[model samples]
Target: MTLEQNPALAPVSDLPGPQAWRDIGVVCPFDMALDHELWRWMPDGVNLIFTRTPYYDQPVGLDMAEEISDHGEIQDAVRSVMAISPAVVAYACTSGSFVHGVQGARNLSKAMVSAGAPAAVTTSEGLLMALDALGVTRVAVATPYLAELTDRLTSFLEQGGKSVVSHEGLGLDRDIWKVPYATTCELIRQADRPDAEVIFVSCTNLPTYDLIARMEQELGKPVITANQVTAWGALRLMGREAVGPHQALLQATKG
Candidate 1:
């Protein structure tokens, strides 16, 4: 009955075969409807499993932010994700991750690890890491959140060492997934400043995977989106090279 003598309990080999595949788990908010967008950019042989944490469809405001960041719900989601035994786990929500600030975000990731995730990440933490990797100091932000949430996002970035040269929001709380890509493009344009180094589009529910390269081309700078950074960070945690569509952040993998 020793594990050494039991093939069933043996560790998987590094040998390349059918059983060799990477699994990335995501803890998404219940209100989010755009997890498919992340799948569009996932590389081959990598599987993404998502567990939706409790979230109200009500407006994305302070109360909603507070509710989504509940340690209990996050822990529950982490436990659910752990059941899949993924290589890494990510809390793929922007406002929820940053609502309690940077320290809170770290604690969220730690919670995931304590819940049995091999590694952990959060959307806000991913955004900051992506920005740093791109060596971007000044940024423009566009979000589907209301003014207060937008302000909180800016503050989070600012406190993390990035300057929010410009920021704008649609003041939206409902049906964020319904927001057209054209509208997000315009919001980024409006938020773009003459000296902004990059554009960041917030909200995991927002459709952004397709717009990243095009927006970067038009704006002549990197365009980082919530889902993009979340995926990138999780892939990094798994020690895999960042792959997917042509986005500036994905291209800049060093550091």
Candidate 2:
């Protein structure tokens, strides 16, 4: 059945106008964590800036909350990047955004727009939206975050109606920029679950465009990561194609 037959598919008409190549500033933790997967998942010609954090890695254990506090000054720091002409700004922290929950992401987005950029923030909350939009209720999660960070992510997902049947975290202390691509892919593979309808790799810093398709094929489910969902959210807000991976979930959903 066409979208014409299903009212739920009404996105084509009400979709915002004039979708085009535009820059989206990322208010990120640790500047160097902004990897190539972001640009690769983007449709084309999207511009970005990675505002680095001094800690440069996922906070270990109890320091996670302190790390979130550390990023509190990000709005002002990222404003400098957003000031350059990017149409949207995403505060790309899965944990920090989740610590605020859905309402928090909305408030953060409102703050960005109010700041003269007319922006949107993609946090762990946005990932909830992405999963909901994809029609998933059961998810498998993989991340570079330690257990505490992953637990926060777990709380956000469970509260949002997505159930995690299988979850794993690398518990790494190294900066994401130094995370080898092979290890990233392996973590996804190890984390893949048989009963999951959706797979979420929760770190924008971890490169994943190349793994989404492969992992999905192996697990037979939709695969998404922090960067992919954030970029897709930003694109849709700006009226762009939420396109597919070579083995992409968005691509697979297209008619």
Tally clashes: model 1. 0
Model 2, span 81-176: residue lDDT tens = 765778877777666577655566566666666655676766565687677788889988888877877787777788787788888989974566
TM-score of each: 0.90, 0.79
**Residue 143 of model 2, lDDT score:** 85
Please provide the root mean square deviation of candidate 1 (C-alpha atoms, Å): 6.8
> How does model 2 fare in lDDT?
0.70
What tens-digit string does per-residue lDDT give for candidate 1 at 12-38? Answer: 774335656789999888887987887
lDDT of 1 at 29: 80
Leading candidate by TM-score = 1
